[model samples]
Target: MFVKICSKSELPEGGVFRFDPETAEKAIVVCNEGGEYYAIGDKCSHGNWSLAEGLLENCHLECVLHGSSFNLKTGWPDKRPATKPVKVFTVKVEGDDILVDIESGVLLEKPDA
Candidate 1:
């Protein structure tokens, strides 16, 4: 099921927005760039750090704690210290609401911490 995250206005282009919808298993980091939105596991696989706190350069989200980087689109890590991939959710825009469906097309459960 899809859950409303937030208004599209709250998510600006070229930035990241963290949302915790009622249906979410945990907080999710939503990336907004060029009128597109992407959702992925919020917590980092390597250090348990919040991925929203990391920097978003293009499709890569860099972990601030250990300099690990993950590709937002595929949840693939581009550097050392993070071997496991994260769970990615599908994002859809319905009117003014940004909806995320974790159960629709999400990746398998994240690796153990």
Candidate 2:
């Protein structure tokens, strides 16, 4: 089931809302751009830094620890230092609420060799 992460008003345009759920140790962030909302893991795959402290432009999330970049849509790292991809959660906007399905679980998987 989806959980209400934050409200549409809480996240400013081109800004991010970092969510630390009371039940989960994992950190997630909701990014808003031009009224579009995207969710991704807050930890950087490179050095495990907080992506919430990193730079965000358009749909690109740059790691604060390293210069690695990830696609907000796919969570795939676009640079070095971060070979693994971060998790991207599904977000839905209903009226004034922004909900996320943390239970549905969005994780990175290894490719079959």
Candidate 3:
């Protein structure tokens, strides 16, 4: 099921938001990249650091602990030290609200276009 994380205005372009649900196993990091919204696992695959605390540039979230960069769209590590990709989630924007599907479980790979 889709849960409302925040409003679209609450997260500006290039901004990152972190959400940890009591019923979920992993936290989620929601990003706003030039109006588009993307969600991924908050933990870095390499260092287990929070992706929300990382820098967001060109849709890539860099891990502050080790500089591992993960693409928000695909959850693939663009930079090294991280060979594995993080989990990605389905995001949908409804009116001024931003919603994410964390109940469906994690997505190891990017969904087919």
What TM-score, computed on C-alpha atoms, does each candidate reach? 0.84, 0.85, 0.89
Backbone clashes in model 3, listed as residue pairs: none
Which 10 consecutive positions of candidate 3 have the poorest summed lDDT? Answer: 104-113
Candidate that scores best on lDDT: 3
TM-score of candidate 1 against the unseen true structure: 0.84
TM-score, cand. 2 vs. native: 0.85
Q: Which of the two, 1 or 3, has more TM-score?
A: 3
For the record, the alpha-carbon RMSD of candidate 3 to the native fold, in angstroms, is: 2.8
Candidate numbers, best TM-score first, in rank order: 3, 2, 1
- Which residue runs does candidate 3 get wrong by more than 4 Å? 23-25, 108-113
lDDT of 2 by residue, 1-113 (tens): 68888877788888888888762347887888677888888888778577878777868888877789777887878779898888889899888899987765476664443
What does the lDDT read for residue 102 in candidate 1? Answer: 61
lDDT tens digits by residue: candidate 3, 5-112: 999888999999999987234899899999889999888888757888988998899999888899887788876899788888999999999999986546566445
Stretches > 4 Å off in candidate 2:
22-25, 108-113
Q: Best TM-score goes to which candidate?
A: 3
Q: How big is the positional error of residue 105 in model 2, measured in Å on the Cα after superposition?
A: 3.0
